[model samples]
Target: MGPDDAFWEDGEWVSWDEIHQQIQYKEWRAKWPNADLSLVPVFEDLISVAEDYFLATGRHLQVYGDIGELYAAITYGIRLHKNFAQGSDGRLGNDHIEVKTIAPMNTKDQTSVKLSGHFNKLLVVNISEEFEISSRMIDRASLPKTSGNILKIRWDDLA
Candidate 1:
């Protein structure tokens, strides 16, 4: 195998979303034939600007949550509900899904999300310090019962 193949097989990945601006509308159409990807440019621009600002100032913009939601929708073929929709974020087939994103700048290392709404399944996403994104999906029934609504999805969940 080549060096690039070895790099990928070793469980390291580079973010392909870095080429967001380079894709054509037709390419997006081919990628998601059932979904409209017209807003890709806007999302790409927002991410680019945020990353640039963070690099220059070393402070994260409060945009990672939104990024995570968008990433989930596109990556997992979920149809999103309108913003501020109570209960859950979107639908995947017949399942109501909620998404939680862990930011790269979270120094505490521990992260938990408050599940205040109704969802059949949960998608926990994390952006590593290196900016590689990963996710874990859990059935609502599999999650541990907590007194509060908090779901403590540790970093190892992504591993």
Candidate 2:
């Protein structure tokens, strides 16, 4: 697992919430100046697409980094337990939802770790633009049985 990746099963949730509440783009960019925002529009666009897909298909959608530790933390946030099953439209209707981030490892980088764990009913989604390294990677996994309307996003449509 990468330093950024965390295992929620044994990690604290407050840290995740803390980062979520505190981290912003401006502040984030101050830390990593070379960061690119070209993908910002793409991120927004993909989010809307995922939202629409979820609404139309009632599927559970999540965004994550390619690192396993990061995604594990996300899955932990969703409270994934053993023997979890897929809900309607390939979603987990339980208190926690199943979403993940699967990024391809760089073949040139021999030290890269694999984040793709075997999920019998896992639903993974990727939302990143080519060659754009995002700094504010977040995992927004939902809790099980959280009754609410299907996602309805508002964003710019390149489509």
Candidate 3:
């Protein structure tokens, strides 16, 4: 098992979109302590706009990055830092976490990590076209040392 097996459950993933749909006719889980339920509607709006835009034109909007980041924050109880924050994106409890978001439309099922980023852990969030989200959270110590501005991690490796 990987270093994150205990927390991530062998890369087991959950679909917030599916859950949201189930409660569409009702109320959202406002008390999800770690998550900002308000952002849910905004994210959904973005999704709807993207879908509409795609249908209108043959182009895509690449909005999944934010969606992916938000997933990591909510799932792992990370409190995100302000915009343009250097190094890590947020903190999970007392540990800093670097979040890498994988866009579904990408030709490859992988993500780019910043070598210069600071964090105690690395959280990679992958979002499917259906908005089904999944993630791989690994302790920083588990990552191999490399020299470069960026590093790549494939979904296969995480799984």
After superposition on all C-alphas, the RMSD of every candidate to the true structure, in Å, is 11.4, 18.3, 13.9
Tens-digit lDDT string for candidate 1 (28-116): 76765655475565556766777888889998889988877777776677788999999988999999999888888977544676677
CA deviation > 4 Å runs, candidate 1 = 1-35
lDDT of 2 at 63: 40
Candidate 1's C-alpha lDDT? 0.74
Is 1 or 2 the stronger prediction by lDDT? 1
RMSD of 1: 11.4
Which run of 10 residues does model 3 get worst, by summed lDDT? 1-10
Q: What would you estimate as the lDDT of candidate 2?
A: 0.35
* Candidate with better lDDT, 2 vs 3: 3
Task: Give per-model TM-scores.
Answer: 0.72, 0.23, 0.72
Candidate No. with top lDDT: 1
Cα lDDT of all candidates, in order?
0.74, 0.35, 0.74
Residue-wise C-alpha lDDT for candidate 2, range 24-57, written one tens digit per residue: 6556356435434333344446556655665687
lDDT tens digits, residue span 1-159, model 3: 333322333466445554466685245454345566656677667767766787788577877777667776656668889989999999878899898877767679888888778888998887766656778899888877678878888877886
